[model samples]
Target chain A: MEFNDWAILEKRVIGWIRKAADHLRASLSNPLEISEKSAHNDLVTNMDRSIEQFLVGKIRDTYPEHKIISEEGYGDGSSDTNGILWLLDPIDGTLNFVMQKRFFAISIGVYENGRGRAAFIYDVMGDEFFHCLSGQGAYQNDIKLSPLTEIKIEDALIDMSTTWLKPNRRIDQDIMTEIVRKSSGTRAYGAASLELAYVAAGLLDAYFTMRLSPWDYGAGLILLNEVGGLYSRADGEQINILSRTSILAARPGLHEYMIQHIKEQVAEGKFLTEPQ
Target chain B: MEFNDWAILEKRVIGWIRKAADHLRASLSNPLEISEKSAHNDLVTNMDRSIEQFLVGKIRDTYPEHKIISEEGYGDGSSDTNGILWLLDPIDGTLNFVMQKRFFAISIGVYENGRGRAAFIYDVMGDEFFHCLSGQGAYQNDIKLSPLTEIKIEDALIDMSTTWLKPNRRIDQDIMTEIVRKSSGTRAYGAASLELAYVAAGLLDAYFTMRLSPWDYGAGLILLNEVGGLYSRADGEQINILSRTSILAARPGLHEYMIQHIKEQVAEGKFLTEPQ
Candidate 1:
């Protein structure tokens, strides 16, 4: 797609997302019909499915040719990211939504021929949106985000999940302790999409999660890409938008250093993956 | 002090906090005076100290008899929570303040005869305030915080530090993991005062931290008390606000259960005076 095409679509999709978010918010304000999916902690509210269906309908009506990868079961179940695709996570933080009624977001990303085109992440309760178009800079509301400044690892504040650091089949505990001790502080907001949005907004220098879905990361990846931030796997490889993989995204200067230092302590074991 | 006197004092203090927060928001908008504190990620900008000094000077001028305990070295050094003592945390989440510039709060609590009298937690950027006059109720931006609903462990979301689950000297990792697996989910917001405010607001079902000062919990304690929540040490004992202790605050039904379950897992020699 041409740049102008992407820009127009970006604007249109943002509007669609805002409207969908408003509808979803209203639905949540009313009593929610909640249920369990895989586990009790893993919830699937009726609103989740209905919102995804609404987003899919809008996308299909507007961009019929584009394939979709979304959280709920309404989108095309394509494996490869070859064509123009829209990635949607109708509710990025469902637990927060069901319990706290806050911290949840609507995330959407557009890719053309496997290259990220545009993205939007909206914190529904806060009414703040972080958005971006490739090569055009990232923005929170209308304020353009600044480029990542020169920052050392120790001086950086990170959003990290501690559940990933325990006696797990992944990274080493000793190294995780070192990172926590070395940094100014750490936070786990329980939402991968919002963490990435915070990174794009420069509220957090870095964010790492052991496992995340593409829908959780799709919109954030585009925003980070626009802000000159690096979002990749734990091994410093480019994130595969279709995989449930460990993610590490940070300001460019701190990403490599964090990965290098933390990688030395990772246990040598193949990560277990469930069938998608 | 009479109840009416406390009410008037709280109103004035709320106004002062609003004005002080306005000054802080303006100073932070420049983004030029940011500086590191203990680590790069651990920030202590000029704004923190200036704000603290400004608050201390005003309190001293207005209430000359009030004894103050604070993070910044402007308050009287006291070992006990004496008569009409004021606990002040100028910026509860300094890292958030210096980095995100949001999600941080200004916390203040007053105690008379060793009992919580009034409390205030101001979300500086969001313009939301969670305040309480003991025996009344908690308020978030003038809206009263409702009584907490009874949520079971399986259906509840709690807040905790990721470090607690790591190989820490303070608590047993296995027990912490058990709690995470049982709960609906876990989150770590990295600011104790605000996290406690979240507890009072029922945004979180429970919150626990390894070590925190009096200033961090005093205001939250008052608010939690007003909302019928429990705040105590990990061992299920009365919290000595002056000492660095394990804090666990939750709805009354869950407080003892959480403390009793986690207290058994305490490491024999893992106590730390300060949170890393």
Candidate 2:
């Protein structure tokens, strides 16, 4: 696409994100109809579906040629990341949305042939928007975000979920516990998009999760790339944006350190995921 | 003291908190001079001491009879919680204050004859002020916060630090892991005062910390009490308010459930803290 076309698409995406955010803010006063997804703890609310449907309708109305990959069932059934693709997670932290009524977000990313072009992650309640255009730069609201600097693991503050530290089916629990002990501090926000935005904004030094769908960290990946951060599979492999996988995002050198540490655990047969 | 006197003191305390908040907001733009505390991960900044001195001076000028128990050195040397006491934590989440530039608070609680009379926990950066008076009610900024209703453990979201879940000298790691698995989800903001305030506001169902100073959760305790919540030592004992101890804050019957579970662990020698 031409530069002018990219700019136009970016502006339209921002508009849609802002519109969805406005709807989210207005809907907070209404009662939420929540239902369980995979388990009782995994929740989905009425607003999550409605917001995804709204985004899908808007996208289809304007750019009918673009394919969508979304959390809710509003996306086209495309298996490959060919041509223009839009990844959307209407409510990134639905549990937080239903329980705390804050800390959730609307995350959207646009890619051309699997290369991220533009991304936006809006904290609906906090009113903070993190966006990036490929090669241009990343911005938090009006201020341009600076590239992330290197930090040591002993000084880094990591954001990770607690479930990963237990005996889960994916990653080794002992290795996850060792990571917690080695890091200076650990925080869990219960929101992947916001946590990724925080990492891009340099509020957190690193973030890792055992499993996340493409839509969950799609926009975050673009933002982190703009800020010179790294994101990959937990075992230091390139991520395929079309599938579910473990993720480890961090600053420049810290990513290698984390990968090396986890690789040692993998060598010991501590990791459950089969080597790709 | 008369009701009018209490009202006057509360207003004055609120004014001081707002003033301190203004100072904090202004100081965020400047570079922080940080220092190590007991451990390398344990940190204290210049602003922490300055804020404590400022609060102490205000209390001394306004009510010289009141004694203070504070994290910093500005507090009076009172070993007992006997008179009109003010518990102050200059900056509850100093690590976050120095790093994230958010999620920290200035916490204060007033006690008369060992009974909490009033409390204030101000999220300095977020512009949220949680305050309450005994027998009156709690308020979040301008809105009067409703009391927290009962919630079961399976349906609850807990706030706890990852450090406590590791094999620490205080508690058993396996017990902590079980607690994480049982909850709907878990979050760690790295700030006790704000976490406790979240509990009072019904944003979080429960919060537990293996170790905390008196000033860390002082105001939070009073706010929880007003909202019909309960707080006790991790071993299910009354917290002495003048010393360091573990804390478990939750709504009504859930506190007892947590106590029973933790006591069972204690009986099995999983809890290292001496039983009172």
Winner by TM-score:
2
Could you tell me every candidate's TM-score relative to the true structure?
Answer: 0.92, 0.97
DockQ of each: 0.61, 0.84
Q: Tens digit of lDDT per residue, candidate 1, span A1-276?
A: 543587788788888888988898787659998888876777878888988998899999988888999998799967898888888999999988888888899999888778888888999888989888888888898899987765787778888876565655565445566777677678888778889999887888899876788889988988988878887787767777888888889988788888786656554443422223
List per-prediction Cα lDDT, in the order shown: 0.81, 0.89
Clashing pairs in 2: none
Tens-digit per-residue lDDT, A108-206, candidate 2: 988888899989999998889999889999999999999999999888999999887888788778887777998889999999988988899999999
Docking class of 1: medium
TM-score of predicted chain A against the true chain A, for each candidate: 0.93, 0.96
Interface RMSD of each: 2.1, 0.9
Q: Model 2 over residues B157-243: C-alpha lDDT tens digits?
A: 999888787787777887767778888999999999999999999999999988988899889999999999999988888998887
Q: Determine which window of 10 residues in candidate 2 chain B has minimal summed lDDT.
A: B267-276
